[model samples]
Target: MTQPHHDGPRTSVRPRPAGDPAATAALTLGVEEEFLLLDPTTGESMPVADRVREALSGTAREQSRQEFRHSMVEMVTPVSPDLAALREHLVALRRAAARAADAVGARLVAVGATPVREAHRTVPDEPRYHDMSRRFGPVAHDPAVCGCHVHVGVPDRELAVQVCNHLRPWLPVVQALTTNSPLHDGRDTGHASWRSMQLERWPSIGPTPHFDSAADYDATVRDLIATGIMLDAAMVYWYARPSASYPTVEVRVGDVCPTVDDTVLVAGLVRALVATAVDEVRAGRPAPRIRDCLVAAAHWRAAHDGVDGDLVDLRTGRPRPAWDLVDDLLAALVPALRRHGDLDLVRREADRLRRDGTGATRQRRIMAGTGGDVRAVLDHLAAQTIAG
Candidate 1:
């Protein structure tokens, strides 16, 4: 469907401050990560998010928040203009969160989903969460899934919308790189990202349709809310969207990475993608015209196979090796990466992930090597989560 050409609510882009070094920097970005709290010995999900929050009261309190489930906690970093600073901030936040979880007799696991949690019975004490539980029933409570959201600065709402359109086809490639959930409810789901499958149960979550302008995007979101399909703009859980609370475009397609380096790699690549999109817009290039259905199929294929199998390459609408797609993605972002002085770091991290396998592959290997012991899988995840 073509987007309606109408001017509606818009956020004005502000001019950069004189002599502000950040204005000349590549792109400011931030990452939000959700983690599962688990008992150290049994590897079972622990409903101690409130306790962890209390433990983090003084230090890093602003950076951490409670998720929908009591078994999950989310950590967000401040805006960072470069990869090195981003890594430092994220690592410190992870360490502090780990310490808080440890104080509550639980450990944080950065896997996409808890392997042994059959159900989530403890919901946060927030009113919004209560409403969600009442409205969604089992699907809301069944999710112990965690994910990583990357936000790249794009102050102009129009440019942000255009960037989202340009970014639609590449999101599946990001998903494939960060597939960390394989086992669900103590059994292999035969999919790399079982967390994604669980999240897809939501009515408003998935690939987004093309929007010609910010007004078109706003109209679509308003229409969905008007139908009572979702509560508000926050519920528009597309893989990529303009952030409602910030002047940035948020990429919500990646699983919560198990290792800090993986998170940094994904963040770098996402920033590069946003930069590339912005450059395209400046060059008067229209966004790619791939159909929403094709984009959705690509996401499904990536979530199903991850880096271990073929993905529906958006360039040709044909299946291709996931690794090859990753290479192509890197090639597409080379100019942006080089401009940002992050090409070497991104390349090294990608190579490392390719050699060692993604979190999903490693989790499967642990399960197989341990004779299908889910506890061993949890142990590996915990170790990796604290490895940085």
Candidate 2:
């Protein structure tokens, strides 16, 4: 189906800023991850969501968004104030999810990308997925890809948009650190993250411009809706956007991390970035204008080289080591890091990635040693699939 078109720019009515200290203090963290269920031996996709749901059975009530029709099952832990608690919750949730999958003759792999995905593995005859396949064609039907999405409560819409803009510079760094999908369709894609590149094909998907205020954002979303370019505000699908359902800014960069520690680290980084951005914006700080081409170029570099890429520092056009830039960000976020009590977790995981390399790197090593056999990579992924 062809998407609708937009004619011209629209006006925005900035919402009156109602800055509340209490609201900001109550900022909480929530995560939504999408994963693929696969046969442990074959590495082919498995349609065992129903069996997994039955496994969860009575426990489903405790987990939010449980019992999915797709081969994937998701869990949302209760809101937590610190990373330690969040870590524990995710660990337990993973175990429950894995146990559910195991009971149904399936296994869960928590990686950014699947090296091989059979299109036929898609949820059989599900209307929603069928409509999605029809709407996005092969993009939605591909059963190999998965992603990690982080949501941080902003309490204010204008602050959410500002957070989205400030987040632009650090996005590539996040992508590089979380790079996992180096192969697609049983072939090496030569890109650090094939998933990131693939998702960019959808309309209005990517980092958007900095809006003046919440009214400006609402007007733009209204225009997109008016033109029928999107079914609703939720369909904006930009890399970062003011979430339609929650009072939070959603960051859709990064692949699914292998460990709960890594997920917590990414979540902490996102929280710090959003908090810092809100402070700067509320204090009347002017944001640097990042040209669309420059942003796209940075994404390409991160996708191609992963940690090996010389990412352009948005603050400075000069190139720097991807690891070096992330270190700087971690240092700059020390205040928010302390606030969230996740500095140690973030630092440790970042150090681990910097030392051993990302999931993509390890997958490539296995493929090279095994003569481009996708099974070798899947074997490793399956071993890690048993939840922490």
Candidate 3:
């Protein structure tokens, strides 16, 4: 099916003056991760999410739910005030989901997309899924991917709208760090994040638009809904948005990371970013005048190179090494990090991720060592998924 033509968001980014450094505070945060249910011996994805959910203990079941694909299940951490608590919650959830999948004779893997040789997973029996499948054909059927979503508490939707702009440039940086879907359908896709490529195929998925206020955001959303480009507000696939069900800013960008440490690292960065953005907004600073096409270009390249190649330096409009951008982002967030007691964690993990490389880098290394066997990649992913 041909997707409707909607040029992402044409809202003009207005220039804002540099203002005083405002107060920063650590925000309560949560994480939602999706995992693939695979046949342990065959390394093929299976439509067994319901069985895994049934096998989960009551508490674990409460923290988990089904994703778009029946071969996938998602687990969410409770609201956490610190990275330590976030790590504990994420680890427990990963273990619980892994144990449940094992009980149902499957392996749960934290992959952005299935490395299995086939794409045959089914959707759950739900009205939303049925509507999506009927409306979009294979576009809905073939999304065989999973992602990690982080929610950082904000005071209000208006503030969340403002913070979204502050987050625009940093989205690509985070994507570069968590590029897990380097291979798809048992073959190398060339792009470090094949999942990102598949997702942007949707008409509404891309950079978040600049908004004048919360009312402007709501009106634009209504206009887009009237265009029939999206089913509802929930379908707006911008990299960042105000939560529909909670008072928080949700950054739904990165892939499902391979381990609890990765999740915590991402959480620390996201929380620090949100906190930093909140400070900027309260200080009367306007959002940056970044072009939509430039943001799109950066995102595409980030998906292509992960952290191994150069990226467009938006500040200078020139190419720079990807890890340099990551470092600059870390440097910008130091104040927020210090306020949140995450300075040490962020510094240490940034060095480690840079040294160890991203998930895509690690997956590529595994393929090389195993003579390009996709099955071994899945095996390694399954092992790492719950190792924390």
Per-model TM-score versus the true fold: 0.93, 0.87, 0.93
* Error in Å for residue 242 of model 3: 0.4
Per candidate, the number of residue pairs that clash is 0, 0, 0
Query: How would you encode candidate 3's per-residue C-alpha lDDT over 189-273 as one tens digit per residue?
Result: 9999998998987878888877767777888888888988788888887889998877999998899998888888998999999
- What lDDT score goes with residue 183 in model 1? 84
RMSD of each: 3.3, 4.1, 3.9
How does candidate 3 fare on TM-score? 0.93
Our tally of clashes for model 2 stands at 0
Worst lDDT run of 10 residues, candidate 3, spans 1-10
Residue pairs whose backbone atoms clash in candidate 3: none
Q: What tens-digit string does per-residue lDDT give for candidate 2 at 160-186?
A: 777787788888887787788888878
Ranking by lDDT: 1, 3, 2
Better of 1 and 2 by lDDT: 1
Higher-ranked by lDDT: 2 or 3: 3
lDDT of each: 0.86, 0.71, 0.85
Least accurate 10 contiguous residues by lDDT in model 2: 1-10
Residue 318 lDDT, candidate 1, scale 0-100: 99
